[model samples]
Target: MTVEVVIFVLMGLTALGGAITVVMARNPVYSGLGLLGTMLSLAVIYVSQLAHFVAAIQVIVYAGAVMTLFLFVIMMIGVDVAEDTAENLPRQRLVVGVLAAAVVGFAVYLGVSQGFDWVPAASGEPVAEATNGTVQAIGERLFSTWVLAFEATALLLTVAAAGAIALAYFRRRRAVRE
Candidate 1:
């Protein structure tokens, strides 16, 4: 097998294992660690695919900032307490199982219909332009085309963070009043 294939297989397996660990682990901290592993593995895969900018963002934004936030939330919520496993909704497990099965079935159907050939037939197109998958290209597109959407997303995140702080402050105030 080729080196790229080998690396892809290893990274894919690591990502799959991490995802399984995240789902199966009962402890919130362990689950967060698993998620971190998954994100890091995905970043490696992005690097292998020559998406260096995306890989850096994956590591910095997801594995760094997002995972830290997730772990902080877990710690703040009291990691010593186990999650309640009792089903509050009737047939919730059954409904979730059916939904999962449907999703898997649809994925399988799409994959089969699209033919699972990994490598595409080569077109006469030129390969490896300097602009391809570079930080410069990404910045150009982000600022030129998607600038408004990016600004909107930033505003949304700021609003969400402010809302969270407001909620926490109000909760603390209410508890103090009590």
Candidate 2:
């Protein structure tokens, strides 16, 4: 097998293992750590595909900034507390297990039957220049074409921060009252 294939397989396994850990972990902090692993592995995969700009953004924005926010939220909400294992919905665990197994089986079958055949973009072409993962191209499109969507995401994040603060304040007030 080629080095690229080996690296791809390793990264894919790391990503999948991290996802499973995130789902199965009882500790919120561990789950966040697993998510960070998954994001970092994905960033590596992006880099392997020659998407340097995207890889940088993935590491900086998702793995660094987003994971920091997630970890902060988990710690703020008391990471020492264990999650309750009470099953609110009957047969939920069984159903979910079956579904998860089926999905895994399908993925395995696809991988074994049809191996990945990635097509690299033609370099030095006009289309490639426009679509290549470059900082200048991304900035141009983000600022000109997707500016509204970008602003909307910022507004959404602000609202979410305000809500978290409000919730924390109310909980603190109730605790003091009690």
Off by over 4 Å in 2: 105-131, 136-178
Query: Tens digit of lDDT per residue, candidate 2, span 92-143?
Result: 9899999999999998888777664344544653354454676777888889
Candidate 1 Cα lDDT to native = 0.87
TM-score of each: 0.72, 0.64
Candidate 2's displacement at residue 92, Å, is 1.1
Candidate 1 ranges with C-alpha deviation above 4 Å: 116-126, 140-178
lDDT score at residue 134, model 1, on the 0-100 scale: 65
Candidate 1 has which clashing residue pairs, if any?
none
CA lDDT of each prediction against the hidden true structure: 0.87, 0.86
Error of 1 at 40 (Å): 0.5
Deviation of model 1 at 88, angstroms: 1.5
